[model samples]
Target: MENCSCKECVSACLNDPGRLVPDDILKLSQFLGISIDDLKENYLVRVPVTSNGHTAYALAPAKKKGQRYIANPGTVAPDYYAEEKGRCIFIDDRDMCSVHEAKPFECGAYMGCRNTFLGKPYRAKTVEEYFYKRWKSK
Candidate 1:
């Protein structure tokens, strides 16, 4: 079987690099030869999940003009969901991921227009739990 070069997938991810899971964060840090703490401080942002009051740590989206692509709609009753839009910081001028080997789970699973299986739906709590643990450790 021929290997899938992931050219299409990478193209789609270049447009919208989706949220990162906790494990992705750790892996990304290691791939970038940095500490988890440094990765979080430098490249991650706390996004509120509306389904729960907890905040999930996600890769910081790239900025354009004076606006951030990630938009937090603020806390709403019952759920405090925020929305992330835009390309990942790791995506370079060539429309490729700088940390493709350590790309987040969402990025890895995305199949672009091919519509392949992209894994199970994300559980915000898992990310929130990771955030709390990391927060406590600090």
Candidate 2:
């Protein structure tokens, strides 16, 4: 999506947050001026991710409820937006990304406002593969 803020795109934020790559985590940590540990404790949650039958825990912005993210992994927050969509913790009440400057790669890659990808739509899968390798090291 480019130069568009359609309802579908806005619904993306209302549905679920995106997965945070390692770099996303670091960026958010610095942007918030907090240690990674504190960020994890307060803003991020570990969720299960699976690819090719292998599963691992990945970090993402927490879900908001009662003024804070449901940061517990064992809690009821949706792990994947495609499967069980929910609200992003960073989305403002006006339906905009509050942390738009430092949003996750997964958020901006696949879904677009006009449902029009800049070049290749499959970049989403490509990015997922890239991150899968990164996470494999953990």
Candidate 3:
């Protein structure tokens, strides 16, 4: 969230993890020095997102159960579930993000984070719809 320090945004990682846009997948892959497929298989969870009464698939930085991200969160083709949702795997001991340089788009762009990377504030659903389109295109 850049220079922001709001509690809700920071504490969000404690339960709900941030959503990822399509470009974030590639950015995170490059940032971690891993292939796109590796990032998808290991770090991301494919989850269902809904907007306008329709459902689509999208990605999120996986929530962790132990020291690792939960496996098979990407259960099926489009409507997958994380089952036991947990904290963000990238959160450090100090409760700060370790991947700020390539953090998920919603983490940096959403109003909950107090840093509007999209130039202005937007409803969370608006952001979700944007991501939904991007994922559907892929």
Report the Cα lDDT for candidate 2: 0.65
Ranking by TM-score: 3, 2, 1
Give the alpha-carbon lDDT of every model.
0.51, 0.65, 0.70
Model 1 C-alpha lDDT per residue in residues 1-138, reported as the tens digit of each score: 112346676654545445566667678878999887777666665543322454433444332212443432221212222332355667767766688676566555545546453443445555445445544322
The TM-score measured for candidate 1 stands at 0.57
TM-score of each: 0.57, 0.72, 0.75
Which of the two candidates, 1 or 3, achieves a greater TM-score against the reference?
3
Query: Which one wins by lDDT: 1 or 3?
Result: 3
Best candidate per lDDT, number? 3
Predicted structure with the largest TM-score when compared to the true one:
3
What's the true lDDT of residue 34 in model 1?
88
- 30-103 per-residue lDDT for model 2 (tens digits): 87788878887777776666667676667777766556455553343454434655677777777788777776
Write model 3 residue lDDT over 52-128, tens digit each, in one string: 88777787777776675554444432233344657886777888887887777777665445545465766667866
Candidate 1 lDDT score relative to the true structure: 0.51
